[model samples]
Structures are given as structure tokens and as C-alpha cells.
Target: MSSYADLLKTPGVARIIAAQLTARFPNGMLSLAYLLHVERATGSYGAAGLVLAATSVGQAIAGPLTSRWMGRWGMRPVLSLTLVVCVLSMAGIAFLPLEVWGYMAIGFVGGLATPPVQPAVRTIYPKMVTSRQLTPLFSLDASAQEIIWVAAPVVTTFIATQISTVLAIVVAMVFMVGGGAWFIASPEVGRVRIPRSKRAFGVVLRRPPVLLSTVVGFLLIGACAAVEAAVVATFGHGGPESGIVLAIFAIGSLAGGLALGHIPVGPWAMTRRMLIVFIGMAGVVFWLDFWWLSVWLLIAGIGIAPALAVMFAIVSSSVKFSDTAEAYGWVGTGQLIGAALGSAVAGFLIDGYGATGGYLTAAAIALLGVIVSAVFKRAHPDLRGRDASPIPDTEPVPVQPS
Candidate 1:
């Protein structure tokens, strides 16, 4: 196999991605499914909206709780648990005749049990490839997620149209089971704990780079989620093709992330130039509510994966290998919290002001990321190009010379 394809053969990396693809494939269909069930059973958008809120709550809380499991029992057990929970959740929704409340309950449980794939992918990346090769690899992962998000929904939608939605969900469940079992068989994932006796929360929380990175992730994810909700609401009812603009928006992000992820940059790369990226990325988002929404969004989306990969690489590089799970978990949690906040707020804002309100609100929130990055540069003159994470096993990260 070629070097790029070789990632698929890597024991741990391959399995982790497989599990991610499996566990998350159905996520694309979730919004549509909620709409279908709620409208079908309760005959009102109000009840459907309420159920979607419950799902968001479940997903938001799931990150932290699962983080604890990943910290304690390690990836294998957590991966297993995620698969089981995902499978069971799908089954309940599939086999049972659900009332509106029942649908809400299932959606909540399903969201809560969703796997923390991005963090897992990050923790294993440094191990899967050389330090220098990490960026492109992460970019590929980001790109793959967008591709999956696009494809999965189309596939599920087709199946539901042809056969039944339940059958489509069952297909998603099979992918999870098959992929989860395969991941467990990998050699690299284990429960070995690295030495860190200090409080994990205190040490990680106080670190400045971590704080900055978490803040940026929070703002970016919020903007993305808000856009997602807004697009769904705004372009809704156009036709069967009405919802496709989201796929286009995501494709833009995927393209941008791929460019950023795969192309190698010089050292201290993101520190000096991030502001330009921040402004441009946030600005294009403001008017992304029209026929041209997808095009601008594509431009806006391009900066995301690259910038995010840079921050995540920096975060991983700064922490001890032992704390990778929790550190990434915290960042993930912040992003999730932001997404949750953005989604919740979009409903209120859109209802009051209009669909355009959502676009403006999301952009304004993302601008905070630009402000935070600027403040970081001003306050910390001494902290440039610093990958704070100590290399593991007392073996210095040679490329880093740390």
C-alpha cells in the first residue's frame, strides 16, 4: 500500500477512524429523523423542536462523562461502550413504537452515548505517524468527516425513501457493530496510564495555550452549529433538494480543512498569521443566508480544518502524553458547549428577528474568537511556537528538541 493508504492499515489509527465513521454515520440523518417522527406522531413542529433540544442536551453532557471513562478504563472499553450504547439506542428507536416523549428520551440517550471521535483521533495521531507528519494526517481525518457527513445523509435519505427509515437506521447500526468489534482487535489501544499525580483539571485549566485553544474551538464550533441549524430552518421546504445546501457548506469546510491539514507550514506557523484567518473565516459567514450562501460558506469553511488542526496539534504537543485524553476531552467539551449554546440561541434569534438573525448571531459569536486570539498575542510575548506537551517515555521529541 502507498503511504497515504497505509493509514488504513495502521492498527490503531485505522480502527479508531473506523469506529468514528461507524458511530457517527447516522448523525447526518438525525435532524431529518427528528422532524419526521415528531411531525408524524405529535402533528406539530413544537413537539419535534422539544425533542431535538433533549438530544442536544444529551450530546452536550455525554462528552464529559465519556471523558472520565476514557481516562479511567481507556479507549478500548470506551469504544466498546459507545458501540453498545449506539447500537441499543438505534434498536430502541427502530423496534419500539415511540410517543413524542419516547422519541425525546431516545434522542437524548443516543446523543449522550455518541462517541468522542475527534479527541480519540487526535490522541492517536502523534503515535500513528511521525511528529512532522501529523498535520496532513489530521487534515485528512477532517476531510473524511465532511465526506462522511455528506454521503451518509444522502445514503440514509435514499434508503428511507426506497425502503424504510428503520431499515436505514439498522444499516447504520451494523456499521457501528462491525467497526467497533474491529477496533477492539487493534494492538495499540490499551489501558496504560502515564504518570500525572497533580489534579488533571487544575494543571490543564491553568495552561495559557490550552485556555486560548479551547476558547477558539468554542467560538468556531458555535458558529458552525448555528449555521447548521439556520440553514436547515431557512432553506427548509424548497424541495427534496432543499436541504442539500448544508452538504455544500460542509463540502467547503472539508475542502478548506484538507488544504490546511495536508499542506505543511513552517514552525511557529499559526501564531503570527492566525488573525487574518480569523477575520476572513468569520466575515464570510455573515451573509451566508442566500442562494450564494454555499459558495461563501465554502470559502469560510476552508480555513476551519487547517486552523483547527494547527491548534489541536499544538494542544497535543504541549501536554504530557498521559493527559492527552483529558486535555483533548476538555477542548472537545468546550466546543460542544459552544455548539449547544449556538443551536439553542439560534431558535430564539431566528424566531424573533428572522432567518438572517441566525447568520448574524453566529458570525458575531465567532468574532469573539478573533478577539481572543488577538488578546493572546498581546499578553504572551514570550510564548511563540511553544509545543508545551512533553514527549513521553523520557524520550525527547527529537524534532522539537524539547
Candidate 2:
């Protein structure tokens, strides 16, 4: 496996990664920015929550379609058109004085047009580097994503509170447009086109490994969302302290991803590690003191990126190359759905029983992921430490010349 430094040295890899990161940074900010903006304008958290829900619903609905479009129409055209619509919709939400219905409509449109940057980049990764470098590359990618999650909220909150909520949203929109444009224009993205899959849309998700990964991803992300809500509830909202606590969780994930390169392990080792950490986190939640809670969160956080990296590796190895982008889209949708469920459920629990209920909810969700993994172990050949080869059943589509 190549070291992180060596991976970046691969021609054109670093540029795409940078552009992808910029395009995705807005993801971390969008929900919070919307929440603040709507709540302030309408004086109703209910309205704000509804708008956020619309955005998630829109993204979940649009994700697979967008990925398929990328395959058929090519990255540049799909991304170019979507980026334009996304920026405009975001501007509408920020600047328009319409009622909650208008905000919901605009938010949905923005999410529907959310740039397919992550899936596009992941689809291009195998073409950029040798098979041996994949694990490290994925680990580095996962780790870098933590930085976006850590920093984006801080920046968004500062601008929204210090300057204006409208400006905060505009800033996020600018990054999305600038980054999406640069990514679409990249030489590598322009040179290669993913040949369209002949199978019906969503068929790729029928494969057991892909389905399993999507379900597990949902559970894991849901747990993270619950934990976030609990942490914020622990320290009341609208303070800098909660942000620092969340950053600690991300830092733990970063440390774990970086450490994964040094450990020589079989294919599903990361999954097992994730399960163990989740169990530990559940047990530690009983402590409940601020410092103790933070310690447990940090420990649980260690498993997050590693688990995601391994899931991506498994999905990559399990499906035909043509199915790659759509497979990732399904996984992304699972995550979005999970986060929504987690927050909604955790909010109810916390309101009724306090932070303890939130912790318990997270633990239960993690255990559900474990159960699913165990039951489907046979279905996931890659998880069994089998030879890391692409599934032989499907023929790979060659990259079409532009």
C-alpha cells in the first residue's frame, strides 16, 4: 500500500481530492445553516426542522438518479448543470422572503441538485492508482473527510452568528459552485467517461454485499447522529463548547484512520474493530459525566472512519466497475436516511428521558448493525478475507474516450 504522502504524489490524484473536498465542505454546513436561517426568520424550530427534512428527503430521492446520469451523460455535463441549479436554489433560500413552503421547495431543489462530487471522485479513484494502493487511498480519503466535518460547522456557525445567516449560506454556495466547476473541468474527469450500465436503475443495489453495506452504513451513521444530539443536549445549544466536543470525536476518527495504514489486517478486520468500539461506547455511556462521556465518544469515534473505509473497499471489490457510482449513491442515501432517523428518534428519547435515552438509542443502533453484519457474513465474500478480486459475474464497462 502506498503511504499517504506517496498517494498524493500520484499525478492528478491530489488535485481531484482537493476539488472534491471543497465541493463537499458545504455538506457539513448546509443543514445547520438552513436550521439557523429558517428558525430566525420564522421563529419556529418546527419550520426549520421541516426544511432540513425536505433537503434530506430530496437528496435521498435524487442520489441514485444523479449517479446514473453521471454514468450516461458524463461527469462534466451532469455536474455543470446540477451545480448551476444548486447554487441558484441555495441563493433563493438565503435571500428570498417567502414563507416556510417556499423555503422547503427551494431547499429540496438545492439538495436534488447537490453535486455528485463524492461518487464521481470515488468512481475515478481506481483509474487513478494501482490496486495495491487502494486501502491507503481510501483510508486517507475517509480521514480527510473528518477534517471537513470538524471545520465546516465551526466556520458556518461563526459566520452565521457573527456576520449574518444569509451570508453564511451564500459562502457555502460559493464554495460549492467554485469547487464543482473546478472538479468538472479537471483533466482526468474530462478524459474518461463511465460507460452507462444496461441494467435497470437500482439493480446494482440488489447485490448482497452492496445492500449489506448500505444497511450497516445507515445504522452506524444514525448512531453518530444520536451521539451528536446527545452531546449538544449535554451542553446546551448555541455555545462553542459543543463544537469542541464534536471536534474531539472527529479527531479520534482521524487518528484511527491514520493508524489503519500501519496495521496489517485482513479484509473485515475493520468491521470487527468497529463492532468492538461500539460495544465499548455503549458500556461507557453509563458513566455520563462530561469528561467521561467525551472519553467514551472519542473511543467510539475511532471505529467510524475505519468502518466506512472498509465498507467502500468491499463495495469496490464486490461490484462491476459500471456499478461503482450507483453503489456508492445507495450507500450515501442510506447514510442520509440514518442520520434523519437518528436525530428524530434521539430527540424524542432525550426529551422524555434525558441524555441517557440518547446514549441507549445509539447503542441499540450499533448493535443492530452488528446483528445485520453477522447474519449476512456469508453474503459478503470480501468480508471473509477471500482473495481481493472484483466479482467475476459482471462484465466491467471500459472507460469511453471523450
Candidate 3:
């Protein structure tokens, strides 16, 4: 499974992975595209930021509910409905000439309608492949996702700058529709329906492993946000160099994720690797030269994807089949909130104390993740080579109408 050929050989795996990636491409592009479009329209960065914030807020609010809906209603119908709403909202943002409030409301609606593609696809993975294939499959999925982060910005920026911002957004909308359609049409997605949980949504989060993973995942992603802010600030805010720095960081993550399946390490080793990288990043706070900063970020990014892969594995193994999507949605929400908080905290610190403050914020957050992991290690028995079995699937599976 180390090679791409072996991974692609899994029946229907390639098709679903392609569908998932295609559906997710816009996720990486939409924020920057929306920001550029709004800024161009309003002639104010502040307005653009507010619109983007609205979008994030909407997404954060909807993520768990959407996941719950997917479990309740099944993937095809829910995804089809959300995708249509998302597309319409994108078109509204592209075509309408709205004030800040208008833009914010539309952006919020767009985000609220954003498809839960990641959680849906991930939840389906275990059912698609054997237990032995799960690790490499997740590793491949994580690594491939880096392509979206790296490519979407380049494509969006080029189109927005060379053509019209409106056109760029339209292009993203086209991709979103096309990808979502492909995913919804896949037979595998249509066939599977996760049993609904008898317990309340809050009960799922009450599980020890779920709770710990959510918190740790939040801090880890928060550290990433801080580092991104610091990198941009390091090169002077809005500098062209910031994009390259981020791309390189993503490349490092891609490399690490590709290597994860080959490594013979316990689950806890993933956390240790993350801690070491964060320490290295914290050490680089003293030396703020651009070249050195880039090198530091690259090194720091090496564990990002692997750590995420580990987190996904842990969450998948720890939760009931019924709770899988919602559990992931909770983790996704943590990452989103953490990112917003990290950027806000880093921005405030950078204003007062320069790039050093941002770097330090990132380090502190990473260390906090380490502390949380250590303290709650018992919750994650998988770290110690023991499976954290799901709460039994006692609920009856609903019959799908043919």
C-alpha cells in the first residue's frame, strides 16, 4: 500500500477519493477568493475580513448539525441539498452588489450550506476497506488533501487577479457543483447508511476519547493558524512571500503524511513528533530572518499531516459507527474555532510585539496540546496499542428505499 498503484487497486476507493478531493477543492480556495472579491468590491480590508469571519462563523455553527443530518438522512439526499444551497449562495456572492451587511449575510448563508464532504467521505472509509488498509488509506487521503491547499490559492489568485474576481468565484462554484454531483452519484455513497445513535449529540462528546481528541485537535490547528499569521507578518503583512512560505509548509506536511504509513510507530508517537516539531518552532522565535523562518516553518510543518491522520484514526476507532460523522464534525469545529482564535490572538500580539509574538503564541498553543494529551492519555487507549471500542451499535439500521 506504500505505492500509489496498490492504493488505487482497492475497488471503488479511487472513485470515492477523487470525488472527495474534488468536492473539497473549493474549501481551500473560497476564503481567499471571497476575501479578494469583497475587498475589491468594498475597497476595505476590514470589510473583507468581516465577510470572511461571517463565513467561518456560519460554517462552525453548521458543521456538527450537518454531520448529524448526514447520519440521520443519509449522504446522497443531504449532500445533494447542501451542495445546491452552497452553489446558489456562491452565485449570490458573485453576482450581487451588496453592502458589508449584505455580503456578511450571504457569506454566512454560503458557509451554512457548505457540504460536509470531509466527514462524510471519511466516515465511509472503514466500511469501504479492510482494517489493514485503513492506515494507508487515511495517510493517502491526508497527503492528497495538501494538493488542495497548495493549488487552490494559486488558481484562485491567478484568476481573481488576471480576470475578474466574480469570474474566479464562478469558477469555484462550477467546481463545487461538479465535484458534489460526482460524489453524490457514486454508488458507494448511496448504498451505505450509518445507524442513528440513540443517545443525544452531547452524549457523543461526553465520551472521554472524543472529548480529548476534540481539545487536542483544536490546539494543534490553533498552533497552525498562529504560525501562518507569524509567517505572513514575518514577510510583512500581505507580502507575496507569505504564500510561498505557506505552500512549502504544506509540502512538508504532505511529505510527512506520505511517510506515515511506512513508519512503525505507536499512536502516542504521533503526539511526540508533534511536540518535538512545536518545540523546534518555538526555538526559532529568536531568529526572525525570512530564509531561516521559512526553514523553521518547513521543519515545524513536517508533523502536521501525520498528526492529523493519527487524530482521524483515533477518532474513527474510538467512536460508534453511528457517531463517526458527528465526532469528526466536532473535531472539525474545534479546528475552525481554534484557527479563528489563533489568528485573532496572533494578530493582537503581532500588533504589539512583532513576529516574535506570533511565533510564541504558536509555541504556547502547541505546548498546551502536549499537556492536554499527556493528562488525558488514558482516554486514548489506542495510544497504548489498545483499541478503544465504540459504544455498541444497538440502534436498528434504517432500511433504505430502493
- Using Cα atoms with residue i matched to residue i, what is each candidate's TM-score against the true structure? 0.81, 0.94, 0.94
lDDT over C-alpha atoms for residue 34 of model 3: 94
Worst 10 residues of 3 by lDDT: 383-392
- Judged by lDDT, which candidate is best? 2
Instruction: Tell me which of candidates 1 and 2 scores higher on lDDT.
Output: 2
lDDT value, residue 156 of candidate 2: 92
Q: Write the per-residue lDDT of candidate 2 for residues 249-274, one digit (tens) a residue.
A: 89988888887743433545645856
Q: Global lDDT for candidate 3?
A: 0.82
Give one digit per residue, the lDDT tens place, for model 3 in 1-402: 446567688889999999889999999889889989999999999999999899999999878889888878788888999999989989988999999999999899988888999889888888777666676677788888999988998899889998989989998998899899999888778777877766687677887767877888789889988988888888864567988888988898888788765453364755675786686578769898767777877877777887777777777777888898888888888889999999999999999999899999999998888888777777765534343223447756664642
Error of 2 at 54 (Å): 0.5
- Lowest summed lDDT across 10 adjacent residues in model 2 is found at 384-393
Residue range 108-190, candidate 1, lDDT tens digits: 89888877655655776776666545656666776677766678777776776678767776777776677566555545454
| TM-score of candidate 1 to 2 decimals | 0.81
Clashing pairs in 1: 256-302, 317-389, 318-388, 318-389, 319-389
Which regions of candidate 1 fall more than 4 Å away from where they truly are? 1-19, 190-203, 240-242, 262-291, 378-390, 393-402
CA lDDT, every model vs. true structure: 0.65, 0.83, 0.82
Q: How close is candidate 2 to the true structure, as a TM-score?
A: 0.94
